[model samples]
Target: MFTPPPSPFPSKSSELSELEMTHDTPTHANPSAFPTHSCQSKQKYTLALRWTIILVPITLIAIGVSTRLFIHPTSFDALSPNSIHEWKTWSKSLTDWSLHERHKPTENSPWLAIVPGTNASPVIKRSTLSATPAPTVPINPTLPTPFPQPYDTTLSPNFSTTSCYNFFLNMTQTDALRSCRPFSLLLTRSQAFIQNQDDINATNIDIWGTCNTDLSSSQCDLNMAWFTSSLRSSCATDLSNQNAMAVSALIGLQAFDLMRQAACSVDPVANAYCYVEAVASSDASSYYFYQLPLGQALPQITSGACNSCTKSLMSMYSAALSSANATSLTGLQATYGDAATKLNNVCGSPYAQTSTVASSSAPPSVDLTSVGGTWAVLLAVGVLSTSMSS
Candidate 1:
């Protein structure tokens, strides 16, 4: 049987060598060729796929970054606040602003203004709004009186679009850049974490009775606590891992301080409404937020008439200046005074005067770390309860 196979046919070992030769000399080179794997087709495709997915995007980014700078406070086109581009744009802006000595907050500042051992009482009284205005209206001797015009009852213009997004959009350069801008800018960087829209509108912060606190007392402090505490379960829980909050993080005691200092108070309830109205008005008119610095931005927002909203607007800086004088919170008076002076020209005097004390210190940084139920921790540092940040 074994001898029969040796006739006219090669042995198994010989066949193996022929097959090896076939592999060595591919089909292109040898006429009598079997299927040649080359074991390279898959590899080439894999490499090409990798480059397309990885290199193409990287190359595009590299080219995009070629002529542009990374950290300078360069001017950028104004984008819609609720858009992803807007979120990242401001986030980059915040990173840029965070670098400046003038723009930074006090190191490790206790952003909260509430007294220890205090419990929160509800400030969201929808029926009424007032800040306990002074008996005599002497903010401007020239202007008839502080409340010269009747209270704009139907204040804070409404918008069809809604979200807790642009809470600080209307924030003046003094307010926004001072305490909340850094956090607001964080929205810009947050898109990486959320491929979808993570933005909330500035006016969306216009929740009814949310800011109904009297800066004159611990009412504002407790209200802030309540707000942050509420965020703990909702937005904060969802975004806690990021250690930041959403972009519109102006929901701290700092807001209360602003109302106290700048806002013309009719009563505690009305005071909150005043602050809201002013913010809503400012946010409504995107007139001032076009990549402009304080020099430009200040006048843009305050350019409106000398209404109660504008009155508080002027007081924000001047009141801060007075507080800085008393508290010796250095490096603040100059900044606050400059804004106040400019606002004085726009609005008037006595509004920024110490007589209407907005606060006793520079507005601390509003952390905006979370919202809903996760806000307490962030509010502890001056932020959203869980504006579950970007």
Candidate 2:
């Protein structure tokens, strides 16, 4: 399979020897036939020199190839143009990695300009792209809220003490955490009562004065001008007994009412359930007034332009009124009307029954008979016309 190239020149030593042998062999008769020994030797020497020059280059090339294989036997096949380019790129990137720790190239890095072979001078210059920055994930806090947990009460005290858990515990004690059992929330309930007592004791005089105007003087009982004073005197313990859970439950009910009104006004009765869960789940306090599906829990209502909702329609409505720049009476009436309409629609038929017309309304039996007779007469007329046509 291997063939060696012919030498370009003959050996000078052999050529000289041949010339000497020829010279001694004959004195040729013809001058043309006679050969000069010196001349032949010189010609032979020149040819030999030429062959040596050519063969030396070939030998050197073969030695170089053999040395390369000996050094890197496995990578010999990868010596092609394409593979060499790839290896160069890889080596460059790897070298860059050590050089610049922060600016290391990634797999997602875009292709840059391409270098072409000698035959083509300039290759297409692609857009140079930097590596994507490391992702920065948000760290969520471990706090808990009325967001439903499993109904399991056997959780560790540490879990209950978490912010989220504490918030839910606070809610559950008030019936706001429907997922939690009432018995498990005794501590939170007690603490809520203590807090309420403090709030009650610190009631503002202005607020108390306002209550007096709405509440009857006779109803005040203890000669206190305001309902707050009456409660401080007689109903103090009663309200304190309510705990935070009851108050939360009351707020939840109000939120549910408001949501129901909003949903009904926007959608048909059939689609109302979608908004019911949505609006109910909008706030944790709202959870107390309604039950969630097995896996569903209420979400938190973030503070914003909207008023912070809690127990007591008067206060909740007042807050909403203040936030939106609406008068107190206007806000209360609007909210109440919406709640009443939704309640009426859900609990009763579409027709409103006025008390004045109760006795004057016709019985159902009479209407049914009348409608039946009308249909029978129409049927007889159709039969008679068909018989005449036949």
Candidate 3:
């Protein structure tokens, strides 16, 4: 462009002023020579934020870890020295008592006698008494006899005649009567099953006025109602699924031998007929129930009593018999609820109110399992840590 002579360059003052204005405006300033104070402040703030993020997470993690260590059972203070010493002493006492009991002989066994006079049934085995006896009154020959006496009959000068019953009666003079009652320890179900037979006989007597004939007889059916009513009144508590299962199992076992007798009986009644058919049809597996006594049904629910060998044996036995399948276990657990409840009633609380957690407190090896999940959990945590670190 044809222009007049180029305008003179801006004066130095104007140029300097323009440069100062440009520097004042943001983005036009140089950062190398002197950084602004605000920039330093921002840098410090960013560093502080980074430090806070790192420190807060570390503190939280430390607190969480400390809390776990404080409350866990593996912590040092859980089983203190005094508690440990007390436990040891208690355990030793139990062991000594057990040894002493083992060495002692069973006082009542071998022979059983029922004497109507004292309302006492003494079972004597090898002439020993297991229980204490009530005080006995001294016999007074001076006092007149309350009842008539039999005439003394002497066969000969040196010999006397005594009946067999009298001879047996005299035997008690030399023998020590057993005082403790005999009961099945782990074999309660089997024993109770036998008792059920006696109950049935009693039922039969009440219904038909005797157990010798079938209920088809005129009076037999009439007695059935009374028999059932008596059973309801006296044994309503005993006629539970637990008792039924035990009885059924025994009956199923005896089916092979009793089928013919049951079928050929002269006067088989409706109930007897049903029982016979059930026995004949049942298989060995019929007794194989899914729910077993195991951990809950037979645990030590009483605090007052020492550790029981019988209970431990029953628990182990039941556990061995338990089904492996979860579904079966669940069903069996449910079915045992009633029996468990009865047991709880027998062993009143706070002992009866046992926690399943206590049962789980035993080592994993106690369950007789080779592979526990603890190792698997540790391995999983290790892999997670490695991935997170990477």
Best-fitting candidate, scored by TM-score: 1
Q: Give the per-residue Cα lDDT of candidate 2 at 186.
A: 17
Reference-based lDDT, each prediction: 0.31, 0.30, 0.28
What's the true lDDT of residue 344 in model 2? 32
- Look at candidate 2 and tell me the lDDT of residue 203: 15
Query: Tens-digit lDDT track for model 1 on 1-390?
Result: 455444577889999998998668564666545454554566666665655565445433432332122222222111112222666665565444222111111223222111111012111111112222222222222211111111112223232222222231322222212222121122122222111111112222211112221132354345444443444433452334432232122222223344334333332434433433433332322212211111122222345545554454444444544554323322233134434444456656654553433332333333222212212222332322222221
Off by over 4 Å in 3: 1-26, 36-41, 53-390
User: How would you encode candidate 3's per-residue C-alpha lDDT over 198-280 as one tens digit per residue?
Assistant: 23332222212111232233343333233334333333333342333222222222221122122222212333322212122
TM-score of each: 0.29, 0.15, 0.16
Model 2 residue pairs with clashes: 9-47, 143-164, 144-164, 144-165, 145-164, 173-245, 174-245
Residue 154 displacement (Å), model 3: 91
CA lDDT, candidate 3, residue 118: 9
| Poorest lDDT segment (10 consecutive residues) of candidate 1 | 117-126
- Tens-digit lDDT string for candidate 2 (1-390): 989997788889889998999767465566677578978778777766666565555543432233222322223223322334587654544333121111222334332222121111121211223211211211332222322222225423432124433443443343323322121121122232212212222112111221223334233222212322322333233335543323222222223323222222211333222222222232222322122111011122222112212222223333433453232122133333233232234334322222211121111122121232123334444554443344
Candidates 2 and 3 compared by lDDT, better number: 2
lDDT of 3 at 307: 18
